[model samples]
Target chain A: MQAYANPTRFNALALTILPWCVGSTVLLFLVGLYYSLVVAPQDYQQGETVRIMFIHVPAAWMAMATYTVMALASAVAIIWRHPLADVAAKTAAPIGACFTFLALVTGSLWGKPMWGTWWVWDARLTSVFVLFLLYLGYIAIWQAIEEPAKAARLAAIVALVGFVNIPIIKYSVDWWNSLHQPASVFRMDGPAIHSSILIPLLIMALAYTMLFLTLHLIAMRTEIMRRRIHNMEQAEVQG
Target chain B: MSFTAPHIGFVLASYGLSALVLVGLTLAIVWQARSTMTRLKDLEGRAAKRRKPAKQVKPQ
Candidate 1:
Protein backbone atom coordinates (compact mmCIF):
# COMPACT_ATOMS: atom_id res chain seq x y z
CA MET A 1 0.00 0.00 0.00
CA GLN A 2 2.74 2.47 0.96
CA ALA A 3 4.78 1.40 -2.03
CA TYR A 4 2.05 2.39 -4.48
CA ALA A 5 1.53 5.68 -2.66
CA ASN A 6 3.93 7.16 -5.17
CA PRO A 7 2.02 8.10 -8.28
CA THR A 8 4.64 6.85 -10.74
CA ARG A 9 4.86 3.41 -9.20
CA PHE A 10 1.08 3.28 -8.82
CA ASN A 11 0.61 4.15 -12.48
CA ALA A 12 2.98 1.44 -13.60
CA LEU A 13 1.33 -1.16 -11.38
CA ALA A 14 -2.11 -0.19 -12.59
CA LEU A 15 -0.92 -0.50 -16.18
CA THR A 16 0.53 -3.96 -15.62
CA ILE A 17 -2.46 -5.38 -13.78
CA LEU A 18 -5.12 -3.75 -15.95
CA PRO A 19 -4.72 -6.05 -18.92
CA TRP A 20 -5.02 -9.17 -16.77
CA CYS A 21 -8.09 -7.74 -15.06
CA VAL A 22 -9.65 -7.05 -18.45
CA GLY A 23 -8.94 -10.55 -19.71
CA SER A 24 -10.26 -12.23 -16.62
CA THR A 25 -13.33 -10.05 -16.58
CA VAL A 26 -14.20 -11.06 -20.11
CA LEU A 27 -13.59 -14.77 -19.51
CA LEU A 28 -15.40 -14.78 -16.19
CA PHE A 29 -18.40 -12.99 -17.57
CA LEU A 30 -18.65 -15.43 -20.44
CA VAL A 31 -18.38 -18.49 -18.26
CA GLY A 32 -20.57 -17.06 -15.54
CA LEU A 33 -23.28 -16.12 -18.01
CA TYR A 34 -23.29 -19.59 -19.50
CA TYR A 35 -23.68 -21.30 -16.18
CA SER A 36 -26.16 -18.76 -14.88
CA LEU A 37 -28.44 -18.68 -17.88
CA VAL A 38 -27.89 -21.97 -19.60
CA VAL A 39 -26.99 -24.58 -17.02
CA ALA A 40 -28.51 -23.50 -13.71
CA PRO A 41 -31.93 -24.86 -13.02
CA GLN A 42 -34.80 -22.47 -12.35
CA ASP A 43 -35.91 -22.07 -8.76
CA TYR A 44 -38.82 -24.31 -7.85
CA GLN A 45 -40.56 -21.45 -6.05
CA GLN A 46 -39.90 -18.38 -8.16
CA GLY A 47 -39.33 -20.29 -11.39
CA GLU A 48 -38.10 -18.10 -14.29
CA THR A 49 -37.97 -14.95 -12.20
CA VAL A 50 -35.08 -16.46 -10.30
CA ARG A 51 -32.89 -15.77 -13.30
CA ILE A 52 -32.75 -12.13 -12.25
CA MET A 53 -30.65 -13.07 -9.25
CA PHE A 54 -27.54 -13.66 -11.33
CA ILE A 55 -27.38 -10.01 -12.41
CA HIS A 56 -29.08 -8.33 -9.46
CA VAL A 57 -27.13 -10.00 -6.71
CA PRO A 58 -23.80 -9.23 -8.35
CA ALA A 59 -24.72 -5.60 -8.94
CA ALA A 60 -25.89 -5.18 -5.37
CA TRP A 61 -22.72 -6.74 -4.05
CA MET A 62 -20.56 -4.55 -6.25
CA ALA A 63 -22.49 -1.47 -5.22
CA MET A 64 -21.60 -2.01 -1.58
CA ALA A 65 -18.12 -3.30 -2.36
CA THR A 66 -17.20 -0.28 -4.46
CA TYR A 67 -18.20 2.14 -1.72
CA THR A 68 -16.24 0.13 0.78
CA VAL A 69 -13.21 0.55 -1.46
CA MET A 70 -13.90 4.26 -1.68
CA ALA A 71 -14.22 4.59 2.08
CA LEU A 72 -10.95 2.75 2.64
CA ALA A 73 -9.16 4.90 0.11
CA SER A 74 -10.71 8.02 1.60
CA ALA A 75 -9.51 7.01 5.03
CA VAL A 76 -5.99 6.55 3.76
CA ALA A 77 -6.16 9.95 2.17
CA ILE A 78 -7.35 11.53 5.37
CA ILE A 79 -4.98 9.75 7.73
CA TRP A 80 -1.77 9.02 5.83
CA ARG A 81 -2.27 11.59 3.09
CA HIS A 82 -1.59 9.01 0.40
CA PRO A 83 -1.45 10.83 -2.92
CA LEU A 84 -3.40 8.18 -4.78
CA ALA A 85 -6.12 7.72 -2.18
CA ASP A 86 -8.19 10.70 -3.19
CA VAL A 87 -7.81 9.72 -6.80
CA ALA A 88 -9.07 6.25 -6.06
CA ALA A 89 -12.01 7.57 -4.09
CA LYS A 90 -13.00 10.11 -6.72
CA THR A 91 -12.69 7.66 -9.60
CA ALA A 92 -14.77 5.03 -7.85
CA ALA A 93 -17.86 7.16 -7.20
CA PRO A 94 -19.26 7.03 -10.71
CA ILE A 95 -18.71 3.33 -11.04
CA GLY A 96 -20.33 2.72 -7.68
CA ALA A 97 -23.22 4.97 -8.60
CA CYS A 98 -23.77 3.03 -11.79
CA PHE A 99 -23.72 -0.24 -9.91
CA THR A 100 -26.18 1.11 -7.37
CA PHE A 101 -28.48 2.21 -10.15
CA LEU A 102 -28.20 -1.20 -11.77
CA ALA A 103 -29.03 -2.89 -8.49
CA LEU A 104 -32.13 -0.79 -7.93
CA VAL A 105 -33.40 -1.22 -11.46
CA THR A 106 -32.71 -4.93 -11.56
CA GLY A 107 -34.09 -5.35 -8.08
CA SER A 108 -37.28 -3.67 -9.16
CA LEU A 109 -37.52 -5.96 -12.13
CA TRP A 110 -37.13 -8.90 -9.83
CA GLY A 111 -39.48 -7.50 -7.24
CA LYS A 112 -42.27 -6.92 -9.73
CA PRO A 113 -42.72 -10.63 -10.25
CA MET A 114 -41.66 -11.88 -6.87
CA TRP A 115 -43.18 -9.23 -4.63
CA GLY A 116 -45.94 -8.13 -7.00
CA THR A 117 -44.67 -4.55 -6.86
CA TRP A 118 -42.09 -2.46 -8.61
CA TRP A 119 -40.87 -0.81 -5.45
CA VAL A 120 -41.59 -0.24 -1.76
CA TRP A 121 -40.37 2.14 0.89
CA ASP A 122 -39.01 -0.69 3.00
CA ALA A 123 -35.82 -0.78 5.01
CA ARG A 124 -33.77 -2.82 2.54
CA LEU A 125 -35.01 -0.97 -0.51
CA THR A 126 -34.77 2.49 1.04
CA SER A 127 -31.30 1.97 2.43
CA VAL A 128 -29.85 0.87 -0.90
CA PHE A 129 -31.50 3.87 -2.46
CA VAL A 130 -29.69 6.02 0.07
CA LEU A 131 -26.43 4.46 -1.05
CA PHE A 132 -27.14 5.61 -4.57
CA LEU A 133 -27.78 9.14 -3.39
CA LEU A 134 -24.62 9.12 -1.34
CA TYR A 135 -22.63 8.28 -4.45
CA LEU A 136 -24.19 11.20 -6.27
CA GLY A 137 -23.50 13.57 -3.40
CA TYR A 138 -19.89 12.48 -3.18
CA ILE A 139 -19.37 13.01 -6.90
CA ALA A 140 -21.04 16.39 -6.76
CA ILE A 141 -18.71 17.56 -4.00
CA TRP A 142 -15.68 16.91 -6.18
CA GLN A 143 -17.21 18.62 -9.18
CA ALA A 144 -18.38 21.60 -7.23
CA ILE A 145 -15.20 22.36 -5.33
CA GLU A 146 -12.61 24.26 -7.31
CA GLU A 147 -9.72 23.49 -5.00
CA PRO A 148 -8.57 19.89 -5.39
CA ALA A 149 -7.20 19.59 -1.86
CA LYS A 150 -10.33 20.93 -0.23
CA ALA A 151 -12.59 18.87 -2.43
CA ALA A 152 -10.65 15.74 -1.62
CA ARG A 153 -10.94 16.32 2.11
CA LEU A 154 -14.65 17.04 1.95
CA ALA A 155 -15.36 14.07 -0.28
CA ALA A 156 -13.36 11.75 1.89
CA ILE A 157 -15.30 12.81 4.94
CA VAL A 158 -18.60 12.21 3.16
CA ALA A 159 -17.47 8.78 2.02
CA LEU A 160 -16.43 7.79 5.52
CA VAL A 161 -19.68 9.01 7.00
CA GLY A 162 -21.82 7.42 4.32
CA PHE A 163 -20.25 4.02 4.91
CA VAL A 164 -22.62 3.63 7.85
CA ASN A 165 -25.38 3.01 5.33
CA ILE A 166 -23.75 -0.16 4.00
CA PRO A 167 -24.51 -2.26 7.05
CA ILE A 168 -27.98 -0.81 7.21
CA ILE A 169 -28.61 -1.89 3.64
CA LYS A 170 -27.19 -5.32 4.26
CA TYR A 171 -29.12 -6.18 7.40
CA SER A 172 -32.30 -4.28 6.63
CA VAL A 173 -34.12 -7.37 5.45
CA ASP A 174 -33.17 -9.33 8.49
CA TRP A 175 -34.02 -6.52 10.87
CA TRP A 176 -37.39 -5.69 9.44
CA ASN A 177 -40.37 -7.31 7.81
CA SER A 178 -39.66 -6.02 4.34
CA LEU A 179 -40.85 -6.85 0.87
CA HIS A 180 -37.28 -7.80 -0.06
CA GLN A 181 -36.13 -11.35 0.59
CA PRO A 182 -33.69 -12.28 3.31
CA ALA A 183 -30.08 -13.26 2.66
CA SER A 184 -29.88 -16.64 1.01
CA VAL A 185 -26.33 -16.88 -0.32
CA PHE A 186 -24.45 -15.07 2.43
CA ARG A 187 -25.91 -16.05 5.72
CA MET A 188 -24.69 -17.65 8.95
CA ASP A 189 -25.93 -20.96 7.54
CA GLY A 190 -23.49 -20.75 4.61
CA PRO A 191 -25.62 -20.28 1.51
CA ALA A 192 -28.98 -21.99 1.92
CA ILE A 193 -29.32 -22.40 -1.84
CA HIS A 194 -28.02 -25.58 -3.46
CA SER A 195 -24.63 -25.55 -5.14
CA SER A 196 -26.23 -25.58 -8.54
CA ILE A 197 -27.39 -21.98 -8.22
CA LEU A 198 -24.64 -20.91 -5.87
CA ILE A 199 -21.80 -21.69 -8.27
CA PRO A 200 -22.89 -19.32 -11.01
CA LEU A 201 -23.88 -16.69 -8.46
CA LEU A 202 -20.38 -16.74 -7.04
CA ILE A 203 -18.85 -16.64 -10.52
CA MET A 204 -20.89 -13.60 -11.50
CA ALA A 205 -19.92 -11.89 -8.28
CA LEU A 206 -16.25 -12.57 -8.98
CA ALA A 207 -16.60 -11.23 -12.50
CA TYR A 208 -18.19 -8.05 -11.21
CA THR A 209 -15.35 -7.55 -8.75
CA MET A 210 -12.77 -7.95 -11.52
CA LEU A 211 -14.66 -5.56 -13.73
CA PHE A 212 -14.64 -2.93 -10.96
CA LEU A 213 -10.92 -3.37 -10.43
CA THR A 214 -10.16 -2.95 -14.12
CA LEU A 215 -12.34 0.11 -14.38
CA HIS A 216 -10.94 1.63 -11.18
CA LEU A 217 -7.38 1.34 -12.45
CA ILE A 218 -8.26 3.07 -15.70
CA ALA A 219 -10.25 5.76 -13.94
CA MET A 220 -7.47 6.44 -11.45
CA ARG A 221 -4.91 6.71 -14.24
CA THR A 222 -7.11 9.21 -16.01
CA GLU A 223 -7.46 11.18 -12.78
CA ILE A 224 -3.69 11.34 -12.30
CA MET A 225 -3.31 12.58 -15.85
CA ARG A 226 -5.97 15.15 -15.25
CA ARG A 227 -4.18 16.43 -12.17
CA ARG A 228 -0.91 16.63 -14.07
CA ILE A 229 -2.59 18.62 -16.81
CA HIS A 230 -3.98 21.03 -14.24
CA ASN A 231 -0.55 21.59 -12.73
CA MET A 232 1.01 22.18 -16.14
CA GLU A 233 -1.70 24.66 -17.07
CA GLN A 234 -1.16 26.53 -13.83
CA ALA A 235 2.57 26.63 -14.48
CA GLU A 236 2.03 27.97 -17.96
CA VAL A 237 -0.16 30.80 -16.68
CA GLN A 238 2.43 31.82 -14.05
CA GLY A 239 5.33 31.51 -16.52
CA MET B 1 -33.85 -21.07 -19.34
CA SER B 2 -37.19 -21.13 -21.07
CA PHE B 3 -38.09 -17.87 -22.76
CA THR B 4 -41.69 -18.93 -23.02
CA ALA B 5 -42.04 -19.63 -19.33
CA PRO B 6 -44.19 -17.46 -17.06
CA HIS B 7 -42.55 -14.37 -15.57
CA ILE B 8 -39.86 -14.64 -18.23
CA GLY B 9 -40.49 -11.03 -19.15
CA PHE B 10 -39.37 -10.01 -15.68
CA VAL B 11 -36.24 -12.11 -16.03
CA LEU B 12 -35.44 -10.67 -19.44
CA ALA B 13 -36.08 -7.17 -18.17
CA SER B 14 -33.63 -7.63 -15.32
CA TYR B 15 -30.88 -9.02 -17.56
CA GLY B 16 -31.51 -6.53 -20.36
CA LEU B 17 -31.51 -3.51 -18.06
CA SER B 18 -28.38 -4.64 -16.27
CA ALA B 19 -26.60 -5.25 -19.59
CA LEU B 20 -27.50 -1.83 -20.94
CA VAL B 21 -26.35 0.03 -17.82
CA LEU B 22 -23.09 -1.90 -17.46
CA VAL B 23 -22.20 -1.48 -21.12
CA GLY B 24 -22.88 2.23 -20.98
CA LEU B 25 -20.80 2.64 -17.83
CA THR B 26 -17.88 0.77 -19.38
CA LEU B 27 -18.00 2.82 -22.56
CA ALA B 28 -18.17 6.11 -20.69
CA ILE B 29 -15.20 5.33 -18.48
CA VAL B 30 -13.10 4.07 -21.39
CA TRP B 31 -13.85 7.13 -23.49
CA GLN B 32 -12.98 9.50 -20.69
CA ALA B 33 -9.71 7.73 -19.96
CA ARG B 34 -8.63 7.74 -23.61
CA SER B 35 -9.48 11.37 -24.15
CA THR B 36 -7.88 12.50 -20.91
CA MET B 37 -4.68 10.58 -21.67
CA THR B 38 -4.46 12.18 -25.09
CA ARG B 39 -4.92 15.65 -23.65
CA LEU B 40 -2.38 15.04 -20.92
CA LYS B 41 0.25 13.96 -23.46
CA ASP B 42 -0.41 17.08 -25.48
CA LEU B 43 -0.05 19.32 -22.45
CA GLU B 44 3.13 17.60 -21.36
CA GLY B 45 4.61 18.08 -24.82
CA ARG B 46 3.76 21.75 -24.69
CA ALA B 47 5.25 22.13 -21.22
CA ALA B 48 8.46 20.46 -22.38
CA LYS B 49 8.66 22.84 -25.33
CA ARG B 50 8.06 25.78 -23.02
CA ARG B 51 10.98 24.73 -20.81
CA LYS B 52 13.50 23.88 -23.58
CA PRO B 53 14.08 27.41 -24.96
CA ALA B 54 14.17 28.90 -21.47
CA LYS B 55 17.13 26.72 -20.49
CA GLN B 56 19.15 27.84 -23.54
CA VAL B 57 18.20 31.51 -22.91
CA LYS B 58 19.31 31.31 -19.27
CA PRO B 59 22.84 30.21 -20.24
CA GLN B 60 23.12 32.81 -22.98
Candidate 2:
Protein backbone atom coordinates (compact mmCIF):
# COMPACT_ATOMS: atom_id res chain seq x y z
CA MET A 1 0.00 0.00 0.00
CA GLN A 2 2.77 2.44 0.96
CA ALA A 3 4.74 1.48 -2.15
CA TYR A 4 1.80 2.60 -4.28
CA ALA A 5 1.55 5.79 -2.24
CA ASN A 6 3.95 7.24 -4.76
CA PRO A 7 1.72 8.80 -7.40
CA THR A 8 3.85 7.53 -10.31
CA ARG A 9 3.49 3.91 -9.20
CA PHE A 10 -0.21 4.42 -8.53
CA ASN A 11 -0.74 5.98 -11.98
CA ALA A 12 1.09 3.13 -13.70
CA LEU A 13 -0.95 0.50 -11.87
CA ALA A 14 -4.24 2.37 -12.45
CA LEU A 15 -3.52 2.67 -16.17
CA THR A 16 -2.78 -1.03 -16.42
CA ILE A 17 -5.90 -2.14 -14.52
CA LEU A 18 -8.39 0.43 -15.91
CA PRO A 19 -8.88 -1.20 -19.33
CA TRP A 20 -9.91 -4.49 -17.73
CA CYS A 21 -12.22 -2.67 -15.35
CA VAL A 22 -13.87 -0.70 -18.14
CA GLY A 23 -14.22 -3.80 -20.33
CA SER A 24 -15.81 -5.82 -17.55
CA THR A 25 -18.21 -2.99 -16.79
CA VAL A 26 -19.34 -2.83 -20.40
CA LEU A 27 -19.72 -6.60 -20.73
CA LEU A 28 -21.61 -6.99 -17.47
CA PHE A 29 -23.93 -4.08 -18.21
CA LEU A 30 -24.88 -5.50 -21.61
CA VAL A 31 -25.45 -9.02 -20.30
CA GLY A 32 -27.23 -7.78 -17.21
CA LEU A 33 -29.58 -5.59 -19.22
CA TYR A 34 -30.40 -8.45 -21.56
CA TYR A 35 -31.14 -10.74 -18.65
CA SER A 36 -33.06 -8.11 -16.75
CA LEU A 37 -35.32 -7.05 -19.59
CA VAL A 38 -35.85 -10.36 -21.34
CA VAL A 39 -34.81 -13.35 -19.26
CA ALA A 40 -35.51 -12.64 -15.57
CA PRO A 41 -38.92 -13.67 -14.41
CA GLN A 42 -41.16 -10.81 -13.44
CA ASP A 43 -42.35 -10.68 -9.86
CA TYR A 44 -45.69 -12.35 -9.35
CA GLN A 45 -47.02 -9.37 -7.46
CA GLN A 46 -45.10 -6.45 -8.95
CA GLY A 47 -45.32 -7.77 -12.52
CA GLU A 48 -43.03 -5.97 -15.00
CA THR A 49 -42.48 -3.22 -12.46
CA VAL A 50 -39.96 -5.45 -10.75
CA ARG A 51 -37.49 -4.64 -13.50
CA ILE A 52 -36.73 -1.28 -11.86
CA MET A 53 -35.03 -3.16 -9.06
CA PHE A 54 -32.20 -4.07 -11.43
CA ILE A 55 -31.09 -0.45 -11.69
CA HIS A 56 -32.42 0.91 -8.39
CA VAL A 57 -31.01 -1.77 -6.11
CA PRO A 58 -27.55 -1.72 -7.65
CA ALA A 59 -27.32 2.07 -7.45
CA ALA A 60 -28.38 1.92 -3.81
CA TRP A 61 -25.76 -0.75 -3.17
CA MET A 62 -23.07 1.37 -4.84
CA ALA A 63 -24.21 4.46 -2.95
CA MET A 64 -23.69 2.80 0.41
CA ALA A 65 -20.60 0.90 -0.69
CA THR A 66 -18.90 4.04 -2.02
CA TYR A 67 -19.51 5.88 1.23
CA THR A 68 -17.99 2.99 3.15
CA VAL A 69 -14.97 3.18 0.88
CA MET A 70 -14.72 6.93 1.45
CA ALA A 71 -14.97 6.56 5.19
CA LEU A 72 -12.30 3.86 5.24
CA ALA A 73 -10.04 5.98 3.07
CA SER A 74 -10.63 8.93 5.38
CA ALA A 75 -9.69 6.78 8.35
CA VAL A 76 -6.46 5.79 6.65
CA ALA A 77 -5.67 9.43 5.89
CA ILE A 78 -6.28 10.41 9.49
CA ILE A 79 -4.55 7.59 11.31
CA TRP A 80 -1.81 6.46 8.94
CA ARG A 81 -1.49 9.80 7.15
CA HIS A 82 -1.30 7.90 3.89
CA PRO A 83 -0.36 10.42 1.22
CA LEU A 84 -2.93 9.38 -1.37
CA ALA A 85 -5.67 8.37 1.04
CA ASP A 86 -7.14 11.85 1.18
CA VAL A 87 -7.04 12.04 -2.58
CA ALA A 88 -9.00 8.80 -2.81
CA ALA A 89 -11.58 10.01 -0.32
CA LYS A 90 -11.89 13.44 -1.90
CA THR A 91 -12.21 12.19 -5.47
CA ALA A 92 -14.85 9.68 -4.40
CA ALA A 93 -17.35 12.29 -3.18
CA PRO A 94 -18.94 13.46 -6.46
CA ILE A 95 -19.08 9.91 -7.78
CA GLY A 96 -20.77 8.72 -4.61
CA ALA A 97 -23.13 11.69 -4.62
CA CYS A 98 -24.17 10.91 -8.20
CA PHE A 99 -24.89 7.31 -7.29
CA THR A 100 -26.82 8.34 -4.21
CA PHE A 101 -28.93 10.71 -6.27
CA LEU A 102 -29.64 7.92 -8.77
CA ALA A 103 -30.65 5.57 -5.99
CA LEU A 104 -33.10 8.10 -4.59
CA VAL A 105 -34.62 9.05 -7.92
CA THR A 106 -34.84 5.48 -9.16
CA GLY A 107 -36.21 4.26 -5.84
CA SER A 108 -38.81 6.99 -5.93
CA LEU A 109 -39.75 5.98 -9.46
CA TRP A 110 -40.08 2.37 -8.30
CA GLY A 111 -42.07 3.43 -5.25
CA LYS A 112 -44.76 5.39 -7.11
CA PRO A 113 -45.98 2.27 -8.87
CA MET A 114 -45.48 -0.21 -6.02
CA TRP A 115 -46.31 1.77 -2.90
CA GLY A 116 -48.75 4.21 -4.46
CA THR A 117 -46.52 7.11 -3.39
CA TRP A 118 -43.46 8.77 -4.82
CA TRP A 119 -41.93 9.57 -1.47
CA VAL A 120 -42.26 8.27 2.08
CA TRP A 121 -40.93 8.92 5.57
CA ASP A 122 -40.36 5.28 6.37
CA ALA A 123 -37.22 4.37 8.30
CA ARG A 124 -35.43 2.99 5.26
CA LEU A 125 -36.36 5.93 3.09
CA THR A 126 -35.53 8.54 5.70
CA SER A 127 -32.15 7.02 6.51
CA VAL A 128 -31.24 6.83 2.85
CA PHE A 129 -32.27 10.45 2.49
CA VAL A 130 -29.95 11.38 5.30
CA LEU A 131 -27.23 9.41 3.54
CA PHE A 132 -27.83 11.47 0.43
CA LEU A 133 -27.60 14.68 2.40
CA LEU A 134 -24.38 13.44 3.92
CA TYR A 135 -22.89 12.94 0.49
CA LEU A 136 -23.94 16.43 -0.51
CA GLY A 137 -22.51 17.90 2.63
CA TYR A 138 -19.21 16.13 2.13
CA ILE A 139 -18.93 17.46 -1.39
CA ALA A 140 -19.98 20.90 -0.24
CA ILE A 141 -17.19 20.98 2.31
CA TRP A 142 -14.64 20.30 -0.39
CA GLN A 143 -16.02 22.98 -2.67
CA ALA A 144 -16.60 25.54 0.07
CA ILE A 145 -13.06 25.69 1.31
CA GLU A 146 -10.18 27.20 -0.61
CA GLU A 147 -7.43 25.57 1.41
CA PRO A 148 -7.18 21.96 0.33
CA ALA A 149 -5.50 20.70 3.49
CA LYS A 150 -8.08 22.22 5.78
CA ALA A 151 -10.88 21.06 3.55
CA ALA A 152 -9.54 17.53 3.48
CA ARG A 153 -9.30 17.37 7.27
CA LEU A 154 -12.80 18.72 7.82
CA ALA A 155 -14.27 16.52 5.09
CA ALA A 156 -12.63 13.44 6.56
CA ILE A 157 -14.23 14.16 9.91
CA VAL A 158 -17.63 14.65 8.27
CA ALA A 159 -17.25 11.37 6.39
CA LEU A 160 -16.33 9.50 9.57
CA VAL A 161 -19.28 10.98 11.43
CA GLY A 162 -21.69 10.31 8.60
CA PHE A 163 -20.57 6.70 8.49
CA VAL A 164 -22.75 6.06 11.52
CA ASN A 165 -25.70 6.19 9.12
CA ILE A 166 -24.44 3.41 6.81
CA PRO A 167 -25.40 0.62 9.19
CA ILE A 168 -28.73 2.31 9.86
CA ILE A 169 -29.45 2.42 6.14
CA LYS A 170 -28.58 -1.27 5.75
CA TYR A 171 -30.60 -2.46 8.74
CA SER A 172 -33.46 0.03 8.75
CA VAL A 173 -35.82 -2.48 7.19
CA ASP A 174 -34.78 -5.08 9.75
CA TRP A 175 -34.67 -2.99 12.93
CA TRP A 176 -37.82 -1.00 12.37
CA ASN A 177 -41.27 -1.69 11.03
CA SER A 178 -40.88 -0.17 7.59
CA LEU A 179 -42.33 -0.30 4.10
CA HIS A 180 -38.99 -1.36 2.68
CA GLN A 181 -38.35 -5.05 2.35
CA PRO A 182 -35.71 -6.79 4.41
CA ALA A 183 -32.41 -8.00 2.97
CA SER A 184 -32.83 -10.61 0.28
CA VAL A 185 -29.26 -10.93 -0.93
CA PHE A 186 -26.90 -10.93 2.04
CA ARG A 187 -28.40 -12.94 4.83
CA MET A 188 -27.23 -15.64 7.18
CA ASP A 189 -29.48 -18.19 5.57
CA GLY A 190 -28.38 -17.17 2.08
CA PRO A 191 -30.30 -15.27 -0.59
CA ALA A 192 -34.07 -15.43 -0.33
CA ILE A 193 -34.47 -14.24 -3.95
CA HIS A 194 -34.95 -16.86 -6.65
CA SER A 195 -32.02 -17.78 -8.89
CA SER A 196 -33.57 -16.38 -12.04
CA ILE A 197 -33.86 -12.85 -10.67
CA LEU A 198 -30.71 -13.12 -8.59
CA ILE A 199 -28.45 -13.81 -11.54
CA PRO A 200 -29.21 -10.57 -13.38
CA LEU A 201 -29.25 -8.58 -10.17
CA LEU A 202 -25.80 -9.89 -9.27
CA ILE A 203 -24.52 -9.18 -12.75
CA MET A 204 -25.80 -5.62 -12.62
CA ALA A 205 -24.27 -5.14 -9.19
CA LEU A 206 -20.92 -6.38 -10.56
CA ALA A 207 -21.22 -3.95 -13.44
CA TYR A 208 -21.86 -1.06 -11.08
CA THR A 209 -18.86 -2.02 -8.97
CA MET A 210 -16.63 -2.20 -12.04
CA LEU A 211 -17.88 1.18 -13.23
CA PHE A 212 -17.05 2.68 -9.86
CA LEU A 213 -13.53 1.28 -10.01
CA THR A 214 -12.96 2.61 -13.50
CA LEU A 215 -14.21 6.07 -12.57
CA HIS A 216 -12.29 6.11 -9.31
CA LEU A 217 -8.99 5.39 -11.00
CA ILE A 218 -9.57 8.12 -13.57
CA ALA A 219 -10.61 10.61 -10.90
CA MET A 220 -7.61 9.81 -8.78
CA ARG A 221 -5.27 10.23 -11.73
CA THR A 222 -6.81 13.60 -12.55
CA GLU A 223 -6.48 14.67 -8.93
CA ILE A 224 -2.79 13.78 -8.96
CA MET A 225 -2.32 15.92 -12.03
CA ARG A 226 -4.13 18.79 -10.35
CA ARG A 227 -1.84 18.53 -7.36
CA ARG A 228 1.20 18.50 -9.61
CA ILE A 229 -0.04 21.63 -11.33
CA HIS A 230 -0.48 23.31 -7.99
CA ASN A 231 3.05 22.34 -6.99
CA MET A 232 4.46 23.65 -10.22
CA GLU A 233 2.61 26.92 -9.80
CA GLN A 234 3.92 27.33 -6.27
CA ALA A 235 7.47 26.67 -7.45
CA GLU A 236 7.13 29.27 -10.18
CA VAL A 237 5.85 31.83 -7.70
CA GLN A 238 8.77 31.15 -5.38
CA GLY A 239 11.41 31.20 -8.08
CA MET B 1 -38.26 -6.47 -23.41
CA SER B 2 -41.46 -5.39 -25.08
CA PHE B 3 -42.47 -1.80 -24.47
CA THR B 4 -46.08 -2.83 -24.56
CA ALA B 5 -46.26 -3.22 -20.79
CA PRO B 6 -48.46 -0.84 -18.77
CA HIS B 7 -45.66 0.82 -16.72
CA ILE B 8 -43.18 0.87 -19.57
CA GLY B 9 -42.87 4.65 -19.25
CA PHE B 10 -41.25 4.23 -15.86
CA VAL B 11 -38.75 1.73 -17.28
CA LEU B 12 -37.93 4.02 -20.12
CA ALA B 13 -37.50 6.94 -17.74
CA SER B 14 -35.19 5.00 -15.48
CA TYR B 15 -32.92 3.85 -18.29
CA GLY B 16 -32.94 7.26 -19.91
CA LEU B 17 -32.03 9.04 -16.70
CA SER B 18 -29.19 6.65 -15.95
CA ALA B 19 -27.69 7.07 -19.39
CA LEU B 20 -27.97 10.84 -19.20
CA VAL B 21 -26.28 11.16 -15.82
CA LEU B 22 -23.49 8.69 -16.59
CA VAL B 23 -22.72 10.23 -19.95
CA GLY B 24 -22.75 13.75 -18.55
CA LEU B 25 -20.37 12.78 -15.78
CA THR B 26 -17.98 11.06 -18.21
CA LEU B 27 -17.89 14.10 -20.43
CA ALA B 28 -17.35 16.51 -17.55
CA ILE B 29 -14.45 14.50 -16.18
CA VAL B 30 -12.82 14.18 -19.59
CA TRP B 31 -13.17 17.91 -20.23
CA GLN B 32 -11.70 18.86 -16.88
CA ALA B 33 -8.74 16.52 -17.35
CA ARG B 34 -7.97 17.88 -20.79
CA SER B 35 -8.25 21.52 -19.78
CA THR B 36 -6.11 21.11 -16.69
CA MET B 37 -3.45 19.18 -18.59
CA THR B 38 -3.34 21.91 -21.18
CA ARG B 39 -2.95 24.59 -18.55
CA LEU B 40 -0.18 22.65 -16.85
CA LYS B 41 1.67 22.16 -20.10
CA ASP B 42 1.40 25.87 -20.93
CA LEU B 43 2.75 26.79 -17.50
CA GLU B 44 5.68 24.39 -17.90
CA GLY B 45 6.50 25.81 -21.33
CA ARG B 46 6.55 29.35 -19.95
CA ALA B 47 8.81 28.25 -17.10
CA ALA B 48 11.15 26.56 -19.57
CA LYS B 49 11.28 29.75 -21.63
CA ARG B 50 12.12 31.81 -18.54
CA ARG B 51 15.13 29.54 -17.81
CA LYS B 52 16.51 29.80 -21.39
CA PRO B 53 19.45 32.14 -22.17
CA ALA B 54 18.27 35.65 -23.00
CA LYS B 55 20.12 35.66 -26.36
CA GLN B 56 18.18 32.56 -27.47
CA VAL B 57 14.78 34.18 -26.72
CA LYS B 58 12.84 34.46 -29.98
CA PRO B 59 11.40 37.96 -30.45
CA GLN B 60 7.62 37.66 -30.42
Best by lDDT: 1
All candidates: DockQ: 0.86, 0.53
For every candidate, C-alpha RMSD to the true structure in Å: 3.5, 4.2
In order, the Cα lDDT scores of the candidates are 0.87, 0.83
lDDT of 2 at B40: 79
Tens-place lDDT per residue, model 1, A6-122, is 888989998889889999999999999999899999788788777788888899889988999999999999999999999999999999999999988988888777767788765
Tens digits of per-residue lDDT for model 2, A13-131:
98899889889989999999899989987677776778888888888889889999999999998999888999999988888888888888988878777767787665556767888
Q: Which pairs clash in the backbone of model 1? A: none
Candidate 2: clashing pairs of residues: none
Per-residue CA lDDT of model 1 for B1-60, tens digit only, reads 898999898888788888888889899889999999899889888889988988988974
Tell me the TM-score of model 2: 0.89
